[model samples]
Target: MPISQAAQRLPDDAVYVRPRMAHYAAVSRQIMAALENISPSVEQASVDEAYLDVSGLERLIGPPETIGRQAKHIIKNTVGLTASAGIGPNRFIAKLASEYRKPDGLMVVHPHEVQAFLDPMPISALRGIGPRTAPALRQMGLERIVDVRQTDPALLERRLGLRLAQVILNQAHGRGSDEVQLHSVRQSISKETTFEQDIVDQARLRETLLWAAQEVGRTARREGLQGRTITLKIRLENFKTFTRQRKLPAPTDDDTVLYRQAWALYRESGLAEHPVRLLGLGLSDWQQDAPSQGDLFDTPSHPSEHAQTPQRDRRTRLFQTLDGISNKFGQNAITLGLRRKT
Candidate 1:
């Protein structure tokens, strides 16, 4: 049945939901808090999914299945939501096990059972194997996960690209990474939006860039992060994507600085003359701590000297005030003047 039709068949009492960013953010925080109590090593895969490293907890928590059940109970009791748990030697196996029996189910894959567990599944079941790639694999007589495992890596590379084939081969043989990383390990934060229709107007494009920069800055501040590099991503109407990046003299979480850098990169791309389908802004090369304050006589290192000026300090304070107001009232309570469609 079509997903839309199935959704309509549900009773009116069913929670027909719409996407709300605040609600999702709250839930994500709750989930992270819950996991932090269970294991010190927790990797958030997405807003709704995560990976927990429970390797050394056997003595305290009993078995892997017991740990899974306890984790589920905590989430249900605390967050009012039930979570599916997957326990395995590696993340790939664990992720697959979790999805195999979902919606409040628990599945455990022991070290010895990894190959057997993967044998019957189709190639598409593997992570990173998209619909387009799956058919090509099947055409090569590699139908099941077992077939891919038995195939030669050299031949696989010849058919698929080198890097992707190696990743698939490693996954097929039950060799997968199990390191659950914390959020601090992330290298970059980005935001992108695809337009409903191609946009050609320079003003609209600039407004979109400003919005993307604002979002990146907001997220960075929330995460207590600041980056030196600001990257601009533009996808033309023909679906050709291009990216340009600029490094700042000092790391910053100021949206104004991010917007200016992104705007500069966008102009340098020479795509202003073409219609755009998508726009993105990213911040990377994170600083260990907040940017340091410079003395009056310090030589300027970057082209944007205004970043070290008192005006920039004032702008930063204004942004912080606006952020507070937005948090208390709502996201749309205040908007950047540049983001306004003029």
Candidate 2:
């Protein structure tokens, strides 16, 4: 579904950085919380639907439907959001239940009822079945779930890869046995912006990069980490997009380095030529840079003793002198004229 269409079906007025993604992560969390008894269960997945398991939770919640109704109520009341819940013997069944009526509905599949519940749903309803695969199945004359189930397991395995073959056959029979790994490792943090108006303004663009750098830096420092790679992403008015990245000389938590490198890359990319509709920045491959005690001037260095190449020494001294001058005065001590204008 188009993001806007899918979003309309959601239970809440959730805020999303990307309007088209139809992401309602916050509202989804609120709905999960309203489910009182099985609330302790770990939330498993957050795809188009959530695959939450409420199997053994019956004893605490009076019944599975009790928890389901409560979850629905919470989504409606507290979150002003709507959700459909599927209660089943396992993750797969629950996902199937949620799909029965998408955009605010519920389904219950008791262990004994799993088969009857699954048999009627189309193959496209199964999680991994894609549009292309569904068409291929139709051409092969295996149009329904039962057809997939009745096909020789070995034949299905031969046609699809072994793993997919087993999964498809299992779904056809309303018997999916995917192990739930409640814990997943964190990878990276990213932020993206869709501009109100596509832009070619260099000054505004530079300010945006600076703002992003400060935000990313504050987050990284607060987490007690530093990133080695800074990435810049841009989408143009025509919708063509590109990404560029720069790896710093050393992993630094310093905002100055990240923003400088990111800005340099943006300029070199010639993105200003195309009015840009979106921008994104990401910091990744993080590690702890040693805690900075103070600035370069804070560390004591003796100017009295000098024993090195005079030419190299002169350049180093010259650079430091210029830096001191800028620190005491202002950055306009050095001026870079704009070679191009928007």
lDDT of 1 by residue, 1-342 (tens): 632355457775555333355577688889888888889888888889899989999998899989999999988987899889888999999999999898889999999999999999999888778978888898999989999999988999998999999999999989988887775457798877777667888888778877877788888887788888888988776567889988887787877777777877877788888888778899999886775333223455677875346755665677789889878997768778774522
Q: Please give each candidate's TM-score.
A: 0.70, 0.68
Candidate 2 lDDT score relative to the true structure: 0.65
User: What's the CA error at residue 326 for candidate 2, in Å?
Assistant: 30
Give the local distance difference test score of model 1.
Answer: 0.81
Worst 10 residues of 2 by lDDT: 291-300
CA RMSD per model (angstroms): 6.6, 10.0
What's the CA error at residue 36 for candidate 1, in Å?
A: 1.5
Best by TM-score: 1
Off by over 4 Å in 1: 1-18, 131-133, 152-154, 157-165, 191-212, 228-251, 260-281, 285-307, 316-342
Name the best candidate (by lDDT). Answer: 1
**Clash pairs of candidate 1?**
none
The alpha-carbon deviation from the true structure for residue 338 of candidate 2, after best TM-score superposition, in angstroms, is: 16
lDDT of each: 0.81, 0.65
